[model samples]
Target: MPEKYHISTTPVPPRLPRIGKYGIVDWREDCARCHNCVKKACVYDRHRQESAYLRTLKYSNFLFFECMGCFYCVQNCTKELLALTINSEYENLGNQYWTPEIIQTTWQQAETASVPVSGAGYRGKFAGRGFDAMWTDMSEIVRPTRDGIHGREYISTSVDIGRKPAHLEFKEGRIVSETPEILDIPIPLILDMNPPEFTLPRLEPFILEAVRMTDIIAIVDSTKWPECLNEKQRQRMDAYLPNIAFHLNSEAPEIPKDVLRKTRMVEIPDSDDALDRRAALREAVPGIVVSIRVPLNKRGVDRAVALVDQGADVIHGVADFNGNEINVKNPRFIKDMIREIHTRLINSGARDQVTLIAGGGIALPEHMAKALLCGADVVSSYLPFMIALECRLCSDCKPGLSCPAGLEAIGFDYGVGRMRNLIAAWYLQLIELMGAMGMREARRLRGDVGRAMFFEQMEEEIFGTLFGTRKQA
Candidate 1:
């Protein structure tokens, strides 16, 4: 059997703010007192004699016991007995992304953070998007020595976020002329500004604050820098405005010299006017990098490369806003898009001179590394923030704009704190995931694409050759 996991639990106490929720196993009080019920099935045969449910009540160290909570007993009962409910008597297991059960054991130590115990237990879904869907080749799980972070094995997760020179010089040779600076970001994430309807103008302000706190960049929509910003916000904005990277329309006939002065980056949706706009914007702004954001379709990738040759330094491609691939015919999907671009860059002479950023479809923590492995330098997430703000992935943010948090209308102090906490939690989760993946630093995770296994590709490569592409046989 696989080794068990356990966490310590104290008797339910008062004054704690109820960090999380624990599930309660509620059985109908009307359970017929006389039935030699068929529901008393236990793998070890303990429940076969009946009345075994009595022992489960005062579970002091429940971690050591086997409740598996399979609900099999509930369904098999002749009396149609049993139900599960929230256990307010105990702390909750986890938060939105980290389910309650996962939080039961500290991800960092691989042991119970609260206390250590062991048992036969399983928690959470087998799969979900991003890293959860990934299995991370832990074939060596039983091998005591190869236990990634805990067993002293090396797993790398660090990544570089900005552009780099395509070529480098040798130390044996005298210094050849060094190439220009292609900026770098320590983390693989950049907060993209989607902007709230009423809180639109303050979007840049919040982004600036985020960059300040996290030491990462924020992608701002240049159009939202309206005049509604307060005096303090505007003054602070001037100091930060210089560092902020602005996303603007590359073909917008005329970009003001003043506005250009504040922006260090420009982005345009894929268009035929790429080269002309890149030149015009560069001539107007001089030191900023021009970027092209494309959907991860075949056509989009083609347009992105064409734009790159025309002097775009940043190539940003993305899948659907909901993390789905664009083309149904060649639906290798988002990561595939990154691989194609990475290979394209290696083939073209521009690989080093340009940076690649892929967004959309990054739902969970491990995806940051996955994208880099697929060859993107940086990735951004939009929906997760909405989730943090209590959006249940409802996607109505663009519709009636019925956010109760006034996320659509804010200058509120609590709003900012709440956002900070959410980001902090996400950052922590990212670090923990990277740690579990045996990746110590984010920079090392770039292009380390071999960490994941693609189900479709694996099946095609392994089964197709044998089946010889059977034609509906």
Candidate 2:
């Protein structure tokens, strides 16, 4: 067996003071100075840490709220002087979709590169919108030998990124068949380009460095090539070329033929003549994989089938930033769209011919696994990479306005380390999830509906007979 894949990580502290969920409110006027106070009994020693943090505080308006919310101090206080209060700043950290909890959890993973554990246990709803509406089966979790992260067994998370032949033909003990080139990435995740609002020229180097370290590919706009890279980076371009995928617009000038020849993969937007464009690029740059980016809207499923039938090496189904279908009031979620596309491809007998990569709402490690279960061969994300560097997602990034998170002034080492740590943490989680599900290969997990349950199906099966059809809100 090949050596196990492991991600080495070290602690990378956050740049700003943490906006923890709870804070301690002490009524000093009513406090009785006991010899042995409840403050000393804090298991986390939050009181002493708060005092130390306050003594050397740099920002005057920033409050200290690192309390663990154990409620031990509040419950055991003699004069009822201590109380736990929710921090308003924590509530305002992220918007509704990108919840504050998600941002904080991402920060913790990037800093520590460890699986997050909510000690208090899950307190949220059983089912909600998007990926939350699905659940994975953990029936095999009790098996001791299936633990992949602990080295008991090997679980492969590697995936290919090109066309795959359905079968082989041979005659006279010799095979004469053509096979397209394929690129194998260690993890089934890709680094996508950040949205226009979050784009930064200085950050590309760090992003490339992170991709190189993780042994994964990143999609970069081909127009920004050569010029955006430093002299040293330009010199080392060949070494990193395999880890980079270029994004080319159909109407834009073609990328230099030399660069395209050296690259392993290139992505083009889905257009009227997408198949023709793919054929042209294949003829121009042999051995280069071409992926068509299909918008995950009303026509996404049909488009994906058409591309696969027309010999596309890869079909990348993308949704809006929030994972919803664009310009549709009653839009289906990206997960549903991926499922529909996957099923259609299977029905059309083209499921094994090409790869399917899904993006645009994959915000967490679990979402990566869930996307594969919904039929994506691989998943891509960009927001978590920025969030690793403490981006608040203010949605106000523009000229003449100072970045609230100081992203522009971030150093290369810090940014790369944080992004690498986040990837390591996510990789560990993926292995752990695969082990628990009793699957040893990521390819086997693709479109394996038996290993997962959809909330809508369960709701309809159980309540439809009792209560008739569900009413629209």
Candidate 3:
């Protein structure tokens, strides 16, 4: 047995005024002004914090909306002067995919580094799009000893990110076949570079810091090296080098041999000669894991299978930010793409040899586990870390635009702390989810659709013969 993987976290509060779901509306005009006010009896002490916040309020439109919606005050008020109201600003956060609720929940997790306990049960739809269309099996919750977060049992969330030989040969009672180097990370997550749509200057250092603290890998574009760092950070580059994986493209300048040798993994964009490039890279740096970044476009599914057939070590399939296929109408989701790729590889007897990394649209911790359940060895995150830095996903996120989050003005400690907290929250949540699913290992969770229920499969089983068949998006 090995030492359990743990992520130590401390509460890192938000700098900006929190955009919570519920707020208190006091109709002071009809107040009885009782000495024993209901506001005085808040178990969470939210009323006292709101009073302090109101005294130093800077933004007129931003009100203190930290009410927990316990409804104790609403029920106890004699004059019926108190009511719980929804915060308009909170409702307006993010688009349909990245809902306001998701953004607010991310904020809370980043701030507290704890699993969110919505006192009220889930009030959303029974079924929806994307990962929401599938639900994990939690029947094991009946057994308390299955809980891995506690000391009852140990659940392994670690995953390997390199190729494995399908079979081995022995000569003279010893293995004669060559052994491949395997890189194992405690978690099945890799922090990816933020999309060009919304980028903050001098933010890479904080991302690198979070990756280093978490002991995971971060995919960094090799073209922007040194330019993204300052004098002090550049001097301390060696310390950050081990946790970083350089991403190379056709247009990017050549990376030095020393940097590539220091890192455990490298990623290159998919091209006509992608396999040739992988072979060249492997020859240059022996035992280094090479990943091919494949965009989840029209040919993504076939392309992934083709790459595997050609002996690709790792294939990283990236969908759009919203998890849909790129440049296609009524696009298929990444979950479906992953299932297709996994099925293809398995049919070819190559699934265990090559690694699959899914990226884009992995916005939450559950999304991480869900992606694995859909057959990804690892999932990459780009937006969740940005959301940790108070990013509102506003229209003004581009360069030369006014960032509503003030991401440019934040210091390294504040930025890195929040990101680390978000990772910790996700780590704990993954463990709890795995425990509830009665899974003792992350690798076993891959393509374990038997432990998951898909709405499409259920609908088809119940109504498909009646309706002929429903079209897939």
Candidate 4:
């Protein structure tokens, strides 16, 4: 067996003070001077830490808003002076899709490189939209240390990319079939290029460094060639080639043979001649995996299945930045689209011959595992890395606009360290999730909907016949 995969992480503190969710309001004027102050009984000891933190505070507007909202002090306070307040800054973190809680959780994981733990149990809605409507089966969780994050058991998160032959013909002496080319990575993740909305800073070098540290692949635009690299990076460009897969659009210039030869994969836009393009690329660079970037719009499912039927190596079905289907009034979410495509491929008997890469709205670590369960061989991660650099998913992230996160001023070490930390945290979380699900291999998690339950499907089975059918709101 190969060595166990691990990601080394160091705590990368946030540059600015975090906008925590909950805070405490103390009405000291009405205090009865009780012997046992309610603040002293905080399970997390946040009140004492808040007092200590305020002593060295430079800004009066900055509040100690790290309350866990356990409600122990609120209920036990004799004077009824203590109240829990939600931070307004926290409420305004992201848009409707990228909720403030998601941003905050991403920040915590990136800073600490550890799983975000809430003292109170999950208080959010049971099910809502997209990935929220799907839940993995954790009925097999038996022990605390069995999660494999602490080395109790080995849970493999590795997956293979590229085309795979359905079966091999065996001769009397040895195998007589030809094996297709494939690229195996330690993790089933690919750092995708930033969407057009997040055009804040040029941190390509840092992203490439993070990819190198994690030993995963990153997709880069072919048009942004050497401009994305600095002089030092250009000198050692060969070292980063294997981790980089240039995305070739129609407008991209012709890539030199030398560059394509060094890289393991490349992605081209979905077009009428996409198969021809794949053939030409394979002929140019033998053993190179070519992924067709299919936009997950209304026609995405059929396009992806068609490509798979035509012997494409990989189909990268991408949605809008927020994971919604583009150019549709009632757009299906990424999860639904992925399920459709995966189901189609499975029915056509081409699922095993081609690899399906899903992208868009993979904001959380659980989304990675969930995407695999929905049938993606790998997932493309985009916004999380930007959020790791403290991006607020603001509308004004253009070149000249004022960035609330101050992304342009970030140093190389701080930027790269945070991204690396986020990746490590996600990796460990994936391991924990796999262990809880009683799964030992990430490859087995693909298309394994038996280990998951869909809200729509369950609603249909349980209540559809009784109440007619669920109507769209």
TM-score winner:
2
lDDT of each: 0.54, 0.86, 0.88, 0.89
Off by over 4 Å in 3: 144-147, 465-473
Worst 10 residues of 3 by lDDT: 144-153
Lowest lDDT 10-residue stretch of candidate 1: 106-115
Q: Using lDDT as the measure, which candidate wins? A: 4
Model 1, residue 348: displacement in angstroms?
3.2
The candidate with the higher TM-score, 1 or 2, is 2
Clashing residue pairs, backbone N/CA/C < 3 A, model 3? none
The residue-by-residue lDDT of candidate 2 on 212-284, one tens digit each, is 8888989987777765455778888887787888889655677789878888999998998988988989999
lDDT of 1 by residue, 279-314 (tens): 777677776676777777757777777767766778
Clashing pairs in 2: none
The predicted structure with the larger lDDT, 1 or 4, is 4
- Order of all candidates by TM-score, from best down to worst? 2, 3, 4, 1
User: Residue 301's C-alpha lDDT in candidate 2?
Assistant: 73
Give the local distance difference test score of model 4: 0.89
Clashes of 3: 0
Model 4 C-alpha lDDT per residue in residues 202-280, reported as the tens digit of each score: 8788899899899999999988897777688899989999999999867978889898999999999999998998899
